[model samples]
Each structure stands twice: as C-alpha cells, then as structure tokens.
Target chain A: MILTEMMMKVTPIKNGTVIDHISAGQALNVLKILGIYHTTDATISVLMNVTSRNLGKKDIVKVEMRELEVGEVNKIALIAPGATINIIRDYEVAEKYAVDMPDLIVGVMRCPNHNCISNTDEPIKSQFLVKNKNPVVLRCLYCEQTITENIADYLI
Target chain B: MFEKRHVLSMREFSREEIDAVLAMADTLEPYAYGGNCNSLTGKILALLFFEPSTRTRMSFETAMMRMGGKTLNLGPAEGSAIAKGESLADTIRVIGCYADALVIRHPKEGSAQLASEFSPVPVLNAGDGAGHHPTQTLLDLYTIRKESHLDELSITLLGDLKYGRTVHSLAYALALYGAEITLVSPPSLRMPDQIKADLEAKGTTVRETGDLNEVIEEIDVLYVTRIQRERFPDPREYQKVARSYKITTDLLKKVKDDLIIMHPLPRVDEIDPEVDGTKHAVYFRQSFYGVPVRMALLKMLIGGDDID
Candidate 1:
C-alpha cells in the first residue's frame, strides 16, 4: 500500500485555535458562531471543502491569538459535531480534543420561538436542552419548542 | 412536593404529585365557598396579568382572599410599568421583593417560566399565550374528580384542540391517569400531532374523529373549549370552525345519563343556553372548582399548614 503525504492548505498558527474537520461548507457558520466577521481583530484563515481520509471533504478554521471559549465550542458542536479544536502554541499542538456537546446549553443560541422570553429585551440568556447530537436537535428549556434543522441559524 | 416550587407546565408533574394536589384540593373545598381559612394570611400574592383575564385573575384573587391572604394586582398592561417598557425580569424582580408568590398571565408563551427565573418567590403560571395553563388543568381535574371519576375515564375533548391551551394541558394530564381520550375537532382544528403522539407513547388509548355524535354516549366527560377568534390567523377561518361544534340539548339527549359537560368558560356561543339547564352541564360548577384548586396550590406552595 502506498500512502501519499497530504499538504496543509492553511499554515499552522503559533498561538491560537485550529478548528478542524468541520462539516463541509460549515466553515462560514463556524466563523459566525465565533462572531468573526471582517471587523474581527483576530487574524483568521478558513479552508473550505478540503479533502481528507476521514471526512472525505471538510473545512478548517485557524484563528491567531485567540483560544475558543467553552460557549463558542459548544455552539460549534451543533453545526460541526465531528470538528476538533487544536490549541496551537509555538507552532505546536498544545491541546487537542473533539468538541463535546453539552447536555444543557446556556447563552449560546437564540430560541427560534418569536414569543419566547429569551427573544424579548429581558435580561435572560437563551437556553436549550441537547436532545440529539448527530442531526443536532435542541429543545428550548422555556417554551419546549424544538429546533431540528438549520441549527446554526439560531446561534447567538 | 410542591413547596416553594414553580408550577409552570403539566409536563413537569408526575401522577403522584397531581394526585397530591387533588387530595389537597379536597381538604380545602369548604373554604372555597364561604369560610375563614387563614392559612396564607401573611403571604402576599402578586397578580401580574399582561393579558386580559376574567376567571383566572379573579380566581387567584378569590383564592387568596378566601385563604385570608391579600393580593396585589398589576391591573392592565396599559396602566402598569410594563407599558413604560420595563422588561418582565425587572417587573418580576420588583414584585418578587413585595410578594410571597407571583401569578402571571402574559400574551407571550413561556413568560411565566421566564418570570420564574427572575422571581425570588415561586412563580405560578396563570396562563401564557397558548402555552401550558397547569392550574386550569388542575382545576379541571378537580372538577372531574368531583363530578365523575378520573379512574378509567373516557373523555371526549371537543372543539378547537390545536390552539386551546386548556385542552392541551388537560389531555396531557388525563393521559397521565390513563384516560381514554376521543378527540373531536375539524381537520384544521384537530389536536396537535406531537401531543397525540406523546399521549399514544404513554400508552393512553386515543381516538381521533370529526364527529362527536359517535363517541358522545360512551364517554365519561365531554370537555369543550371555545375556538378563540384571536388564535386564528384569518377571521373567516375562525368563523368556519367556531360554529362547527355547538353543544345543544338535542345532542345531550344521546349522552350517557351520568355524563358531565365542562368548559373553561367566558364561552361565547359554543354552548346553547338551552343545554345549560340539562343535568350534563357541569361547567358552572367546574368554574367554581378553580377556587378550591387554587387555594390548595397556594397553601402547598407558600408553606401554609393544612387547614383541617
């Protein structure tokens, strides 16, 4: 058997997070969850639809000088459940682990229910119970409304 | 089990807890009529109704007064700080400081659950849009227990099942007691698929049909809910369904001799006045049961001792 060396599309970051194995075409959504737009201060690179032996085709996001927060990582799990976060320090993998979906998600995403209290100007963050992981189903803790599709569309 | 707990939804309750509330309600029945029970004497209940209410607001107030407790009313949304654009959290916090418990009715779904998060005291959901009205369900259960038997109850829930919050909670609660539910509604106004599925999953016998005449004679209770004009997106659609299921004396002739009819009233024309004279009309009595059921809830939630 012949194993060909794979080339890295995006250069490794010295001190930041490298989110890899994001579901194909979800790189932008991951960025949206991270609140990283053109005005974002963190230097970032997003590689979309990259070939891989594991995922066939995947997306990768590298952010310079910023480690992902626990809330951000949990939100990423909704959109890219198979994704892994590698903390890069001095161009070396410092910490690497797959995102674990939280049983109770808090302050991470907006509930789609228009009449939900979380949608009002009240001082309360949205909450959801993770009912399913693969297809990413969420049940709002307050209204009991379920979100089964387009999970990223509700990211806070 | 209910002490200092928020009564938000019927889904949160178990059969034992529901039975406990019903048992407690039985003990508090005397005070509901005309008696002095100072169980909740020192406890001040705050009534925060962002929506218009007749029975619920008055029921809570009557429950508190009957128990020798005072109530603070927020009146209408037009007159309250809510009109000044204060958030529900702030309103709850401010009222929580003054009251021992808060009973809220809002136009938005899940408002009481949201208020519970901010309230220092326990929050009781009176009604929240088309969401759960657990107390109403409790009172309905209490009425059923008094007028009929919850054991092996065969109930036919008629009228607007889709948007009727009372029927939704009642159906779920009845399912807990293993009631055989026959749902009668127009196709567009039928019980929600999710609720029907949940009921069936719980091993409750559920039958759906458009005709109430087929099931009227066999059922133990007929729970009717008004098809609200506000719940419909179109007035014409509302008019079409609103007139589809009126209870008349002619229909009552076919029912079982002991069968009782109930509605969560402020009813508009769904029940003919002629049927009000029939033995089957227990709705007026059903309305009265709200007082005792709420009294039991107040006593249980606010650390009030057993009156007797």
Candidate 2:
C-alpha cells in the first residue's frame, strides 16, 4: 500500500527513542507526555495517520538523544496502551518493548478531581492506582475518584 | 488500627475495620447519650469547616466535648486565611501544628486528602464536595446496624443517586456486608454506571430502576436523598425530575411493616410530614448515632486504651 511504503521511507534515528503503534490521532497527546512543546535541542519527528499492518492507522514519535522514562511511559500507556517503545543507538534498534503500566502511580499526573487534595493549595502530591491497564482506568488513591473517559485531559 | 491515620474514603476501610468501628461505637453509646465519659481528655481536635454544615460540625464538636476533649473550630473556612488567598496546604499546616487531629470539611472533593498531606496529625474527612465522606458512612453503617442488621437486608436508595455522596459511600459500605442494593431514581438522575460496575465487581447484587413503587415491597431499608435543584446544569431539567419521587405515609402502605426509612437530613420537601411520625422514620435517630460513631472514631484515632 502507498501508506505502508511511505512509512518505510522515513529516516531512522541514530540515538533516541521511537514510540511506535500509537493509536491513530494521539500523536499530540504523546508529545504532551514527552513535554515536547517548543523546539528542543534534540531532533524530534512526529508522524500521524501512518498506515500500520496491525492497526489501520497509527502515529509515531521519534526523539533523538533521549530515552523514555518510566513515568513518561506510564502516561503514554494510559493514552496508548498498545504502543511499543523502541530505543535507538548508533542508527540501530537497541531495545524494544511495550510500555508496562505500574500498579501505582505517584505525582506523574494531577487527579481529575478538582476538589482532590492534590488540586488544593496543600502540598499533597497526586497519587493514582491503575484500576485497569488496557483502557487505562485510573482511580485516585486519596479521593477514590475514577478517571476512564478522559485520560488525556488529566495527563500532566 | 486507625491510630493517627487519615480517613479519606470508604474504599480505604475493609469489612473488619468497619466492624471494629461499629463495635467501638457500641461501647461508646453511653457517652453519646450525655453520660459522663472522658475518653479523650486533654486531646485537642481542630474543626476546619470550609463548607456549611449544621449536623456534621455539631456532632463532631459534641463527640469531643462529651468525652472531655476540647476543639479549635474554624467556622466557615471562607472567613479564614483561605479567604485572603491562602492555600489549603498552608491553612492545614497551621492547624496541624496546633491540634492532635484535624476534621476538615471543604467544598472541593479531594480537599480532605490534601489537608491530610500537610497536617502532621490525623485528618478526618467531614465532606469534600461530592467525594467520599468516611465519617458519615460510619454513622450510616451504625444506623443500618441499629435499624435492621446490615446483613441479608434489601436496600432501596431513592432519589438523586447521581450526586448523592452519602448514597455512593453507603452503597459501597453496604456491599462489604453483603447487602442487596436497589437504586431508584428518575432517568435523568440515575446513579453513575461506574459505581454500578464497582458494586458488581465486589459481588453485590445491584438493581437499577426508575420506578420505586415496583420495588418498595422487597426493600427493608429505604434510604431517601433530596433531589438538589443545583445539580442540574439546566433548570428546566431539574423541574422535570424534581417532583418525581417524594415519600409520603400513603406510599408506605406497599412497603414491608418493619421497613426502616433513613435520610441524610436538612431534607427539603422529599419526605412528607406525616411519614415523620411513623415507626419507619429512623432518620432522626440515625442522626443521633453520629455522636457515638464519631466518638468511637475519635477514640480510635486519638489512641487511648482507657475510657474513664
């Protein structure tokens, strides 16, 4: 297919991380997860609506000179659970694995509850439990308020 | 087991812990009845009520005072440093330094948890927006235990289940004791589907319906909550479901003879005046149980063995 052929033509990164198989149309959310708002010193490439063998359409994010952190991966897993993380070194894939969400998340994202202690003026850090991983159901440990529908909106 | 701990949600308590609280409440009943008891003498409690509450606030104060303990009350937090743009953290930190325990009621859902983070002492959730109310749940469980044992009884929760924090917490607590729950509300004000799934996951039988008359006969406890006019974004929607489910003495004809009716009071026009005189009306007594339950909670949290 034309889309698959074009996907193969993109240049490979020498030393960086490649987030592959992001559910189509979530590349911007992935960028937010990586904290890549403005132009950074490192090279960054984001491909949206790319054709995939498994998924009909997908998005990919490539960042040079930086590997993904567990907290970042956790945020990504909430939005794109099936996405794979590929670390590239010297123009070859060095490590490849799917993001594994942690059972408990601390201070990564703010609680969706506006009244949550985390959102208050207090020094309380947000804490969440992964109630479900596949669709990313997060329950606030303090308030017990569940966030399933808008996982992206609450992502820090 | 709950010594110097933060009571934030009903989810934090297990069946055994709930049983323990109820047992302690049973032990402290005499003090709740104005008997002389000094369980928490010299212990100081800080009452931080950021919201307006007559029952919860007074009950906590009474619980401490009856047990020979004192309170530092910050009436209507809007007047505190919070009004002058101080963060909830700063205010809690200041109070935490002064008191052995903090009782906070805020307009925000997670405010108690936030206060617990800053306070060095134990933090008790009075009510946080629409979030969990652990103390209220304790009183509710106590009421349930008193009216008609918590186990093996069918419960019908009437009216606005959508925004009723009491109903949400009560349902979760009741499930721990294997109570069959039936939720009755207008279609527009139904209980959230997520709560239904959570109850089912915990192995509780939950039935949802719009008609209360159809399920009234099978119910042993009818817990009614008012349909707040503010919950609706559009006032027109509120007008439609407002009068859909009011409890009257005439409606009690279809219910079981031993059925117990309860409400988290400051109720507005939901239960008819005639029903207040019926034997089923245990809501006032339920409100009375708050004193003993809270006294039990203070004892558990304050960490003293002897109740003088």
Candidate 3:
C-alpha cells in the first residue's frame, strides 16, 4: 500500500526532495543528514517505520521547498545504503535515483581514531575508502583504521 | 617513477612499485657496499628528526652522502624551534626551502602526511608514531627478497602487532605478494581486527595465534617486533607479555635450517644475543640493505629518470 493512501497522516511536498526506502529506525539519522530540527523553517514531513513493498519496513522524508545537496545524498548512502532519493517538482516526481556509495569518501566524516592525523591541528582532510557498502565499512586513508559500527556518531 | 613523489605509507604502493624499488636497490648495490656512485651530486637532503632514531636517521644520511649529496641534519626536537612550540607545518615549510627532499620521523602518527602537504619537496616518511613506516617496509621487502622469495612464503609476525607500525606496514605489503601470514601476539597486542579482515579479503591466508611454539615450525620467515613499553597505556599490562616471546639459539635449532629471522632492531631481550651467531640472524645484514634501498628511493625521488 502507498504511504499517502494508508497513513493519511502527512502531506506531500510541492517542490523539493523525498528520501524513500531508508532502513527502518533511521529516519532521525536522515533528519540529521538534512540538518532538520524543531526550529527548522522548511515544511518537513517524516514517516517512520512505514510499511513498504520494496523494503519490509522503511522511512520516508518529505521536505517542502528544500532541495538536497550531494553531500547530504552521500551521508544518506552511508547510513542507509539502499535508500532512494526522489526529487519532486510541483508535487510530481521529476527525478529519482538511489544514492551511490562512492569508493573514496572525502571530508564527509571524521575518522574514529583519536590518534589519526586528521584529528590533529594540522590542515588535513579526513579521507576514507569504502571497504564495504552494506554495513558502511570505512577505512581511514591516513591511519588505516577501519570503522564498522557507530558510523552515525562519526558523522561530520 | 617516484620523481617528486612523497612516500607516506606502504598502503599507497602497488606490487609493481615495490618491485621497482627492489630492482633499483639491486642496481645500487655497489654504491651501498663501498663504491662511490655520486649520483645525487648537487641535490641537498634534509633530516628532520622530531623523535629519537638510530637506524633510520643514519641510513638516510648515509644513503644521500654515498650518492655524493649534502645533508642538512636537524637534530631531535628538544633543541629545535619545535621545543618552543613551533608547529610541524611551519617547520616543514621552513626546511622545504633549504633542501631538495625531506625525511621526517615524528612521534605523532600522520605527521609525515601533514609534512608532505606543507613541503615543496618530496617528503619521505622514516617513521610516524605507530601509524606508518614506509621506508622500513621497503628495506624489509629488500631483505625478504634477499633471504627468501617474496611469493608464497609462510611468514609469522610475532609480538606487539597492534602498535608496531612496521608489522602493520609489512603485513599489507606481504599480502600483495600472496604471503601466508601467521600473527602471534598476546590478546592485548593482537593485530587490529580491520587489518586482519582486509588481508583476508585480499586472499592472503591469515592465521591468528597466541602460541609461538605451535606456529614456529610452519613459518619460513620469522618477523618479530618489539613490544614497546610506551605503547601500553598501563605499564603493568606490558609486564605480563614483555618476555613471553623470546628468540633463542635453542629454539632456532628446532626450526627449519633455512628459516630466516628478522627484527626492526634496538632489541632489548626479545631476541637473545646468542642468536646473532646463528645463520638464521639476517637482521644486521638486513639493516645494511637500508642504505642501498634508500639510495634507490632518493635517486628516484630527486635525481633524473634516465638510469641504466
């Protein structure tokens, strides 16, 4: 069943982005990526743990009059690898595609290693090589520390 | 191909690049031994040692001098501007103006990578805290090639696998050549889970063990690293495993006659002095290879590309 037809709980956006198929329980993280808070001025609608035919359970975020940036897409891909990004124009789906988990992630997140050079006062950007995409395993390019869990905590 | 290139980590090198370095080292053997090559005549090399080092500092200084190049030696951090709280970037930028190439050894991991950015010249990482030591790994490769073949050798890396940057760098490099590695360290100092996983994914057979006697005979090359007193957050924890794995002459008798023993030295008690007389000890000879290997690297970095 479609989200709008079943819930009748939230309204759709006129022109903006709709992040769909986010893994269940990650809607808050998606909001974190979008930098949304209670004080956010943009009209935002969040559907948590909604029933989806594509995924067993998914989260959908609809933001009115707010377009998504490339960094936001990359952040979404890291937390929720299988999520799809939908661009809506005039309440119509204009463009849609799943975010690609890039092989080399530059400056999107900080390395978990406390001793990592990127963490130092030196002017060096944290770079990571995506070792695995499903669970979002990232390896630090400089220190070579692999981060598998608590990835959301390390978000930039 | 290393012309004006900064060697920050062994992870940055490919198998072909490693072979290129080994081949160049072989070509520069005469210059390393006693012959005067004088290839880097007009070039100036800088030695910026923020930490104390014996082998690495001397080898680089010797490598450049043998090639007829001059060296600007910046002694340890205490007497320098760094003691007065000068930043690494400022120090590197200042030294970059004085030399054609810079070799740095710092206590902080990733300082070499940071130095590479600030310097106009190529930056060579002599050693960087527990992060990486690319030059040591190169010399290890050179030694491995000299003693045994780089391919399909069962190598055991024992002791302090966690904080030993040499083991970390070597493990990655050896995996490139399809070496079957057996890592033996105490529970506290085991190989980092990520490195072991990455190596396993790369098709290198990795075995983790806490016992040295069980895996000793199976190893063709015994690569040992010292369990550093400083690496342990608690000194009492280091005491538990400090003398656990020692290489003695009696133990070497039980192993293969051709089994090669290697160490990144400044040995305390991990390797007994008695083993030095045995044919198994190749570490001193291994230490000597650093000069030629570094000479090859210096030539590649600073000198022109037309080498015969």
Candidate 4:
C-alpha cells in the first residue's frame, strides 16, 4: 500500500516539542502564533478537521527539526487547552506538556474581552487565574472575564 | 483636581472596583435626590459629543456640575469643529487644552481610543458610536445589585446583542460577578464572538438561543435591548429579525415574580410599555441612576476617596 503525503507516517524530530490533539480546525491558528507553520530547514505537517475519538473528530500536527519554547507552546494552550505537547529525543519521549494553567497568565492569551488590559498597546499583558478542574478554564484576572478555549492556548 | 481617564467600555473595571464605584454612586444618589453636591470645587469637564445624546451627555455634565466642577458643552455637530473635517484627534487635542477632563461621544467606533491618545485630560467615553457606554454598565450593575441582591443571578439578555454596546459591556461586567448569561437574540443579532467565548471561558454557563420563551422563567433579570437599525448590515434582514424578540407583559408569566427587566433605552417596541407597570421593569430607575453613577465615576477617575 502506498501512502500520500497527508497519509504518510510522520517521523518525529530530536529534542523538539510535538503538539498533538489540536481540535483540527485550530491547528493552523496555533501554528501561526507559534511561528512553526513555515520553515526553511524544517518540515511542518498539518491534518485539519479530521476524525478522532477524543474530539468526536480532531486534528494533528508533527513538526520536524524545530524546537518549541514554553512561550510558543502557550500560544497553543490559549486556543486549544485540551492539546498535549510531547518532547521527543531520538524519537523517544523525553518530557510531556499538558497545558499548564498559569495562576496569572500575562501577555499570553488575548483577553476575550476586546477592551481588555492587553488590547491597548499599553505594554501590559492580560493576567488570568486557572479557576477549574477536569476542563481547566482561564479567567482574566483584570477584567474577570473568561478567555475562550480557542484563545486559551496562547496565554504565554 | 480631577484627572482625565478613558472609559470606552466597562471591561476597564474589576468586580471589586465596580462595587467600589457603585458604593460611591449610592452616596451620590442622595445628593441627586436632595440637591446638588458640588464637591469637585474647581474642576472642568469638556463635553465633546458629535452625536446628540440627551441622557448620557446631560448626566455627565450634571454629575460634574453637582460636584462643583464646570463643564464645556460642545452643543451640536452642525457648528462643532468636526463639520469642517477637524479630525477627532485634533478636536480632542483642542478640548484637552482647556478642560481638566473630557467626556466624549462620537458616532464612530474606536473614536474614544483616538481621543484618549491626544487628549491631555482623562477621556471618559460617553458612548462611542455603538461601541460602549461603561458608565451605563456601572449604573446597571448598581441597579442589579440593589434589586436582585445577587450579582451572580440568572441573567437573560434579550434583543440586539450584535450592536447593543450596553449589553456587550454589561455582559462582561456580569460575567466577572459569575452571572449565568443567556444571550437571546435573533440569529442575526447574536453577541460577538470574543464576548461569547469570554462568558463561556469564565465559567459563565451561557446559553445562546433565538427563542426567549424557553428560558424566560429561569431568569432572575430579563435584560431587554432595542435593535439599533444603524447597526444592521442589511436593512431587509434587519426588518425581519429586529422585532423578532419582544418582551411583553404576557411573557412575564413565565418569569419569577421578583424578576427585574432592564433596558438601556431609546427603546423601540422590543419591550412592550405594559411591562413598565410591573415591578419587573427596572429600566426607568436604571436610567435614573445614570446621573449618580456617572457622578461617582467622574469622582473616582478624577481622583477622590469616594471610589470605595
């Protein structure tokens, strides 16, 4: 059996973060904010609006030759809180990252409130509290409004 | 001296800060009822309104005057600097020079941000087009707390969420206090994306439905809003959905006996006049609070111990 580029098995990179379980539609949104969507020496694969068990249907992305920093990983966490990041070395799991809910996330997630503290170019980041369990929620500490799940992964 | 502040939206205040403002408003309410307070002594508030606003513009001016502050009213747009293509920035700069603070209402969105950039004084946003009326939110919050006795009550937001800037600002204020918000509008006039996500993410437990009958009884406060024809994309479409949801007295049968109905007025048929007779209607009293609540805001933003 032959596999196309979309269907082919993706080989993991050494010492880079592998972000998995994005809600298919938000993969590119995550990539744009993380700056991993385009690369010169790296390969970026994205599967969008795909079928999955966890999400009833979900999407996946495997980036080769690029390492993701905590700040960049936060971009994904803002939008897709359910997303999981796995650190790979020699195609072996080195560490795992389940979106860490920061007690006060500043300049990370864009406050769902447009008039939020972060919206003004006023050199201040939005702060939020991780208020719940099971499905973690980010509450804007300043405005006390909720940052949407779609915008959650970005709270760096 | 009263300093300048930009109050484009209610999102500027926190739950506690809002409460503080309300407390101050309670103090101002007495002054309004008895007579003028005139505590500001010798400050000035510049009223730069391109659009005609009866309540808000007058309220702020009155608030400042009662506090012993002077006001510069930019009466109408016909002869105002804006008629001659004088930019908002330029006008704000002009106003910022003489006044200690600015209270502005322009017909354009984001005009307040632009004004705040140039205005030397703190720019209190009166109402920037269909954008926001933060002072109104403060009063609305004050009214809800007084009548409902709970900030986190079951709130039903009816009518035009798309352009009802009051509702947009109020929703976030309510969300901060942990209110369960149900946005009821025709599909065409639903709440904006950022706000919807804001409510859901903050554990607001929001319900977005086109129909109001299903949830009218469950609500503690039925927040009615008028559909602004100016905010519509297609006039034909506006005609179809603008009046789709109306809160009549008969509809209150499903509501709690103590349910409070509110509207940031200049209302159309969205709320039947019959509803006004019932205790459920707080829109009038809510509208009345504009003077004192804004007085409290002007005092706080201008630097006063009255904030708490």
Highest lDDT: which candidate? 1
True contacts kept of 4: 0.00
Off by over 4 Å in 3: A1-10, A35-58, B1-4, B74-94, B151-154, B180-220, B228-244, B254-256, B304-308
User: A76-110 in candidate 1: lDDT tens per residue?
Assistant: 88889999999988999989999888898888789
lDDT of 2 by residue, B111-142 (tens): 78777777899899998887878898889899
**Native-to-model Cα distance after best TM-score fit, residue B125 in candidate 4, in Å:** 0.7
Interface RMSD of each: 0.9, 2.0, 1.6, 7.8
Candidate 2: segments with Cα more than 4 A from true spot: A1-14, A47-58, A105-126, A141-145, B1-4, B76-79, B209-211, B229-244, B253-255
Candidate 1 per-residue C-alpha lDDT over B1-308 given as tens digits, one digit per residue, 9 for 90 to 100: 55438899988999889999999899889989978788888889999988888889999999999999999999768888878898888999999999999999988887999899889998999988778899999999999999999999999999888888889889989998899999999887888899999999999999999988889889899998887778778898888777768888888887889999999997898999999998889999999999999988888888765574
The DockQ-based CAPRI class assigned to model 1 is medium
Worst 10 residues of 1 chain B by lDDT: B299-308
Error of 3 at B227 (Å): 3.4
Candidates in order, TM-scores: namely: 0.93, 0.87, 0.84, 0.64
- Model 4 Cα lDDT, one tens digit per residue, B58-175: 7787788777788998877778776777766677788799988898876655567667767787888787665667888888888898788555599989887886778888888888
Candidate 1 residue spans exceeding 4 A from truth: A1-8, A69-71, B229-244, B305-308
RMSD to native, candidate 2: 3.7
RMSD of each: 2.8, 3.7, 4.0, 9.0
**TM-score of candidate 3's A chain against the true A chain:** 0.83
TM-score winner between candidates 2 and 4: 2
Give lDDT for model 2.
0.86
Query: Model 3 chain B: which ten-residue window has the lowest total lDDT?
Result: B299-308
Most DockQ-accurate candidate: 1
Which pairs of residues have clashing backbones in candidate 1? none
In model 4, which runs have C-alpha deviations exceeding 4 angstroms?
A1-156, B1-4, B229-244, B304-308
Task: Indicate the residue-level lDDT of B307 in model 4.
Answer: 22
All models: lDDT? 0.88, 0.86, 0.86, 0.74
